[model samples]
Target: MLADAEKNGPKPAPLIEAFRRTWGRMIIGIGAALLGVGGFFLMTTFIISYGTDELGIDKSVMLNATVIGSVVEIVVLVVAGRIADRIGAWTVCAIGGLVTMAVAFPAFWLVDTGKPALVYLGVGLGICALSIPYAPIGAVVSGMFPEAFRYSAVAMSYNLAGVVAGFVPLLATSLTGAANGASWGAALLLMVIAACTAAGSFASGSLMRRERAARPAGDRVEVAV
Candidate 1:
């Protein structure tokens, strides 16, 4: 099974085992993360096409969420990049989990505010929370194996994720329909995506953290690579 196989140790040849680790986790994590991200596009598409009725907002205000989210992504990317460079991927991922937990809570309150701009603020924070840990995930996947199989494993994961990315808009649309047939309602349904991310990612990060932490304290993470 994929789960059992993922938990297994590295092979005698580091490259082979590294291929196994990256193969199982990378495609799954990236696809899921993108799909979750694709939810933003979905929300925008729906709101742009459908309009925000429940919130009494104009189309221009709704677009601000994207603008704000872009800014948020920049902040997250810069900070996460530094952390990934310094602290190791797994620890960053774990910390991201805690940040996600805190971020998700505000979303619930933002919905009640009924101001589209405020909602955008909360959404921006959520996007930032989601993005900050992403740097480590890719690095972890890329470095899992020796040079031999790294290309194959990493490429396969990215390609598969690209394939899966196409399906996100459709799935997100369905989720919107299921959520009271309104675009804003989609936010509630989207939380499920976040929940799954926390579970699977925390698992991935925790596993890697344990593996990396087993090394001597003075041994730097880069040296482990």
Candidate 2:
């Protein structure tokens, strides 16, 4: 398998050309990655803090909620991937983004309600929404670039998202403090981030469709160079 892959691997020159051709779409994908991954980090970082400090919930209960939410996310990830395969990755991602955005305020509200069960439900729902975009995002980003540049483009975008994700926790915490322990600001920020991801997903999807339509019928399918 390794030998066969190497035989058909992309050439350097074509990889460069592929990057040049798809740079715009790549940018959109990177933007989506930043938001999607950052939002995930933001939620994970603050759920415990908010539950204990602001909502007066027990630490152990919050910890259990996080664990349960993670388990639900894993299951949702698989289901989301299967759905994306049937519909379209971008569509699934966009839908997920909308759901995440819609749920942000309510999730925060539920957490602030100071009910343990509601808090668990809110966290679980948020995780499910996060999984929707996440599951198919790998394929969606890779599809934005030609096969020749897929690896490089995907890696760069993903790493950039990681950088954003690393900071989101601190940022959310600061914002929450600034709002006098109110979670609405933090929730709003997440909603805005999710919106960016949704917009980017739609834009990248449109670009891919255009590229596909522009290809000549009899022309050789562009492989990895």
Candidate 3:
């Protein structure tokens, strides 16, 4: 099986050529990655801190929520990927982004209520929202580039986004503190980030469609080849 797969695998494209052909789409992918990944990290961080310090939730409860949320995320991720494959990755991601943005404020509001069940519900909803965009992001990024440069372009975009996302925890903490322990400030920031991700996914999808439209039928086949 390994030998057969290796023999049939696609050859890697020259990186320089791939970058030249897909640079614009790569840029859009990076932007989407930054916002989407950053928002996810920020929300997780806020939940941990805010739940413990402000809401006085028990540590065991938070841990249980984390475990359950992880399961929900994995399930949602698979379902989201299947949905994206049937319709379109960008459409799925855009819809996910909108859901995430819409839920940000309410999720925090629920947590602040200091009710255990509501807190768990809020965290679960947030995880589900994050999973929607997270699941289809890889497909969307890969589709932005030709097969030859696909791996390199996708890695670069995702890694760069990871770097940006690394700062989100600190930023969320600082913003929340600045607002005098108000979670709204952090929630608002997350909403903006999620919105940016949605816009980026929408734009990337539009660009991909335009590129396809501009190509001659024969050229499109050749390019894919």
Compose the digit string of candidate 2's lDDT tens values, residues 111-181: 78778898888888777787788888877787677555677777777887787678877888888899999
Candidate 2 ranges beyond 4 A from true positions: 1-23, 214-225
lDDT of 2: 0.78
> Is 1 or 3 the stronger prediction by TM-score?
3
Clashes of each: 0, 0, 0
Q: Between which residue pairs do clashes occur in model 3?
A: none
Model 2 lDDT at residue 1: 30
- Candidate 1 — which residues are off by over 4 angstroms? 1-56, 108-113, 182-185, 199-225
* Candidate numbers sorted by lDDT from highest down: 2, 3, 1
Q: Which ten residues in a row have the lowest lDDT in candidate 2?
A: 216-225
Cα lDDT tens digits for candidate 1, 1-115:
2354478744356446645656566644553354234444544454344345545657677678767877877888788878777766645655665566565557535633658
Q: Which candidate has the top score in lDDT?
A: 2
lDDT against the true structure, each candidate:
0.56, 0.78, 0.77
Candidate 3 residue 151 Cα shift, in angstroms, is: 2.3
Model 1 alpha-carbon miss at residue 143, Å: 2.2
Sort every candidate by TM-score, greatest first: 2, 3, 1
Q: How do the residues 128-218 of candidate 3 rate in per-residue lDDT, one tens digit apiece?
A: 8878888888767776765457778888878877987888878888888898888888888778878877887888787667656776787
